[model samples]
Target: MAMGNSVKAPLGHIQFCEENRSACRGRDNSPVVVKLTEARWNELIDLNTRINRQIRPVTDEKLFGKLEYWTYPRGGAGDCEEYVLEKQRALLAAGWPKSALLITVAKDVKNAGHAVLTVRTDQGDMILDNQIEAVLPWYSTPYRYIKRQSTREPAKWTGISDTRVTTVGSVGN
Candidate 1:
């Protein structure tokens, strides 16, 4: 997805940054697009599948007694944001460039806010969604892209010029 001007980040993300400082620390002004290899593709697909299958889809309120909370689903359950964080963290731990793994927010087909990991690769932006089993290209999804953690700085956000339009505020990213 093409990025737009910087914008205010979702409230949950701000709080997440406060709690998980390291996740939001660091900055690389230059853009990075990963060279996607066949092996890398398989790794991403398998990782997505495993995480989706492992974590129980529980709301933040149910899991943390809050309206919106962002953290790893280490306790076995979490919502979309947690899944995205987990995916991004996994790739980072595997030595993938942090700039290539973005935390994206968008609205689902129902207009409900949803979060997904958007990986910038040589091919294009690919969506790693908890709701979808297959790893799909960003344009292939039925989401209205809104904003995402900037590739240059994970803590900063930039709008996505998604012609479909939207924001997933209530969904928690």
Candidate 2:
């Protein structure tokens, strides 16, 4: 699916980017338009599972004694954003194009802020969420889709029109 116009980054995301500027520096902002091969899809699933199993979810308040969102986990545990970061990193290291992998923020079914990795594939936009093990189409989730990193610019982002999407499987924090 075509992405929407650029939008402002979420406050928490901005903070994470600022704190991790060194790592994010010089990142390519071009959109990823490549289609995923069968092997690539398997690899993505493996990476997602590895991170999901390895990183135990912890709240920002508990981890930092305050609200602090990090792009990647500094320790063994982290929240949603960190999961997305790790997955993105793994994909990048595996030679996946930076343009195709995006960090996305959305509101869950309960309206709580959540993060996930959005892989831009030729078939469609697939979401790799910490809350769920199975990778699914972006439109299949119960989230109130908010904004996602711009395909043209990683630092920049674009707004997503909210739709009444239904949850297809078990709920996750």
Model 1 residue 148 lDDT?
A: 97
lDDT of 1 by residue, 1-173 (tens): 77899999999999999999999988897878988899999999999999999899999999989988988885889999999999998999988999999999998878898999999999999999999999999998888899999888889999988885444456566
Write out the backbone clash pairs for model 1.
113-168
What does candidate 2's lDDT look like per residue over 1-173, in tens digits? 44577788888778877877754545564555657889878887888899999999999899888686675776778999889999988888888877788888888877898999999889888999999898888888777778888766567888887655464677789
Q: Pick the candidate with the highest lDDT.
A: 1
* Best by the TM-score measure: 1
Sequence-dependent TM-score of model 2: 0.87
**Model 1 / residue 139 / CA error / Å:** 0.2
Clashes of 1: 1
Question: What are the clash counts of all predictions, listed in order?
Answer: 1, 1
lDDT of each: 0.91, 0.81
